[model samples]
Target: MLSTSLRVAILIGIIVYYFILIMLLRQKRLTLKYTLLWLFSGLMMLILSVFPQLLNGITRLLGIQLQSNALFAILFFCTMIILMSLTSIISKQNEAIKQLVQYTALLEKRVREIESCGD
Candidate 1:
């Protein structure tokens, strides 16, 4: 069971995290699509913090020996998923950047050729 102080801390952390996320979104630093996952994570944390029994039940259902351990496991899994998603997005952007650079080079070469012919 989480102590009262621990629960309060978790609640405060969740609120602060949410505030930061909202500020980032308002400043156009974070896109809605990317923020969705973070928002969901914050909501889950808030729920778990507010209802420790829910987490306890989940830990029991998962056969986890400790509630804290179960919470860590869930957090680790979510982090890995978010990392993989970001990696995929980066990879796609890298491929697109490569293609754009090649296209630009080809266009430049064609322009040079046309200018030479005009000369």
Candidate 2:
């Protein structure tokens, strides 16, 4: 069980985090698709903080020995998921960039050939 003070602190921190995410979204620094994961994370944390019993139940269901350990495990899992999503996005963007570069080179070569013919 978390102390009242600790729970309050966590709640406050989550609120601040939500505000920051919203601010970034409003500024166009983060797109809605990417923000959804973070928002969902914040919502989960909010639910856990509000209902400590839920965390306890989850910990027991996962066969975790300690609540703290459970929290760490969950955090690590979420981090891994987010990292994988980012890696996939980066790979796709890289492939698109490569294709764009290749097309640009071909176009440039054609332009050069036309210039030589006109000369």
Best by lDDT: 1
Give lDDT: candidate 2, residue 67: 69
- What TM-scores do the predictions have? 0.92, 0.88
Candidate 2 lDDT over residue span 2-108, tens digit each? 56787798799999999999999999999999778788878877887788777788777988876657665776777788888889889999999999999999999
Lowest lDDT 10-mer window, candidate 2?
A: 66-75
Q: Top TM-score: which candidate number? A: 1
Name model 1 segments beyond 4 Å from true: none
lDDT of 2 at 102: 100
Candidate 2: segments with Cα more than 4 A from true spot: none
Q: Candidate 2 at residue 56, lDDT?
A: 86
Please report, in order, the local distance difference test score of every candidate based on alpha carbons.
0.85, 0.83
Pairs that collide in candidate 2 are none
Write one digit per residue (lDDT tens) for candidate 1, span 21-51: 9999999999999778788878887887788
